[model samples]
Target chain A: MTDNEQRMARAGDYVLGLMSEEERDRAEHDMERDAAFRDAVLTAAQHFHKLDLTTAPEPVPDQLWQKVSERIASLPQMQAAETAPASPSKPRVAANARPKRFGLHSLGGRGGFAIAASLAAACAIGYFGALATVTNPQPVVVVVLDTPANTPGAIFEAFADDSVRIVPLEEFTVPAGQTMQVWTLYDKAVGPVSLGTIGAKATEVRLQGPHLPLPKPEQLYEITLEPSPGSPTGKPTGPILVKGFARQPARS
Target chain B: MDATSDDDLCTALLVRVARGDRASLGELFAREAGRLIAVARRILRRSDLAEEAVQDAFVAVWQRASTYDGARGSARAWLTTIVRNRALNMLRDGARLDYVDDDMLEHFGERSADAEAAYAALPDREALKQCLGQLDASRRRSILLAYVVGFTHGEIAADLKAPVGTVKAWIRRGMIALQECLS
Candidate 1:
């Protein structure tokens, strides 16, 4: 099929819920980047929505509304438009921004490579300064995972307390039935253990991982796409989206 | 009120909801919740789960109303999409379904019936009805099963007694043709 035909077909699959979890993720990611595909999906979705309207209204329980109101009572609306008046297309811009590539010229594969150039350039400016002032214990080691395409995907700060803070540089789309699983190869014999899983929208967040020996230098850190809940095999089975080697943060 | 004006009112109320107005959300809920619950019920086939889906959707609508761009679609469509997505997710989560001892064949039969019932209910005047009518029966059934009832390719294959690959092709080609006719 022609490219446009294929795109329209995929859009239909998306609208019809026929795509697999991974295919849905790719389609959603494409929707952000491809205007035509987005338009196609939206149009198809709207058209098929006529069927939704035909559904006879069911009796909504009085408590349902009350429950919804209570649930959202503490939640705040994300005021994206009002907050960023000058940057009307801020989300679009962020979506389009390529993952930052750090200068890895001198750093060879799986080496400590001192926390000098890339760390300072990529992370130190914001996270280091902010984290230093916070009451949270200092991270034992930091890792900058690179996408297979060699662009920095996320930053991981492993702490002494078995908590890891993840700062994703790129917006990885995790559709409903899938999750992003974080893993570390602390021991080759033990294999890669899951730190935890995160939902679709990735942001700077801390995850309390399983108790293991203090994370050391050059430990493998990676994130993979897995079935919801986690990898069934309890090992890294899915395709790794990003991977990196750990580096001990220089003591202040 | 007519559908267009009802949709317009929803858009206006959603704009207020985006500005942190709780009353507007309540209004939208009063207006759309019943219909949304019914829509979710078609996919979930359980009133309690349907209610849960609509409740979650309302919370999401409250939290993410600011992101709603009316230029993309109608407020009603947006609301329906959110509820449908939530219901589909709940349906896909195997733990919730727990098909262990239940008659899997009977469940599939009922879901397929729900899917067809939805398509048959579409208004005769709707372009969607016309476009869907143009597709072959297999194509049309596959598309309906997927959209109206959240059937995966595998489920549709099982329902139609066709190979998975064949069901996938039917849906892809069917959707392409449906869009062409709609456009």
Candidate 2:
């Protein structure tokens, strides 16, 4: 077989979890640019896919299955266990339920665009001069915050107290009926408590954290646009307008 | 333990599950446990390890049910992929697939040496077996090496001591035959 054919066959194996970690990575990369190669891989994958997954994954012994059922049935959130594929039937979330981004889950293909526009509006309002300074006797130092990659967005300054003020990197216009809810999460939590909500063209966000013991690692700060009364669920139910994670500066 | 694929029962169980109903989750499990655990065994190659893997996988599904995306693949594919990945990792982390403990070893059956034991032994395994049986041994072996052991085509070719071309043909022919058989 040609290198191309061999590569295509390898991609099928990778999808099947047959390849080792390294080979799997390589196959994934090669399959990306190779359409014909991908088709061949999918062709083989469909064949293997037909193998009654029901028959291959041996049944859990009666006792063990019972134990698992008991444990799963005991959890407060048994959604995962219930969705676990058991019979030959399809799943509920299999091609019908859609995931929403923000604004009580504002739908459509442009969901991502709305989030960007909100951030842009926030940024546009900031650089055009929208910062409110409170006369606190504590020392004020400028702190740099970055998103996934450091984009020109916003900066934050904290008072001696755990409260910090967010200064936008650009001027942004937030429409009425929408508010920016802020949150700080240290670890992967199911629900993150809200910090506070900011209004339109509001450059500075004043937040008090009785819960923020310290500016811990992975302590994320995100701003989501919620409804007027804020998220009734106590979490940011809107699209994230702006977000940044604290990163330590590198010393020379 | 479950044999009936009653649609209403399945739908009712899912709705309660969405509402965080644990009892419903148990009922659903009782109905599906025999089939799913059987799947775990074939993929894991050891009943004991398969039992634990299935147990862990199910509990995880229960906790993260809301995260399921309908646009992805079928629920069966999703669940099977999870357990299959789990079992593969369980073996990949070690050098071999043998992880049977005393409890599992004690329950040994006649033909436990085969990796595809669950799928092969099942009456439901008919379609795939007929499909695969149509292919020559060399082609079937290549497909099995890839699916059963999760070996890459290169690995299959290397292990079988054949050129990559022959391995690819065997896999292609085998899959085409399968698609027809299952269809």
TM-score of every candidate:
0.59, 0.43
Error of 1 at B147 (Å): 0.5
Which regions of candidate 1 deviate over 4 angstroms? A76-252, B99-104
- Model 2 segments beyond 4 Å from truth? A1-11, A22-50, A53-252, B1-19, B67-73, B95-134, B148-183
- Candidate 1's residue-wise lDDT over A13-121, tens digit each? 8787765556665666566557798889888988988899888898888788889877776554234433655522111112211121122312332231222222322
Question: What is the per-candidate TM-score for chain B?
Answer: 0.95, 0.61
Candidate 2: Cα lDDT at B131: 68
Residue A82 of model 2 has an lDDT of 63
lDDT of 2 by residue, A78-116 (tens): 455467775432111112111212221233334433433
Residue pairs of candidate 1 with colliding backbone atoms: none
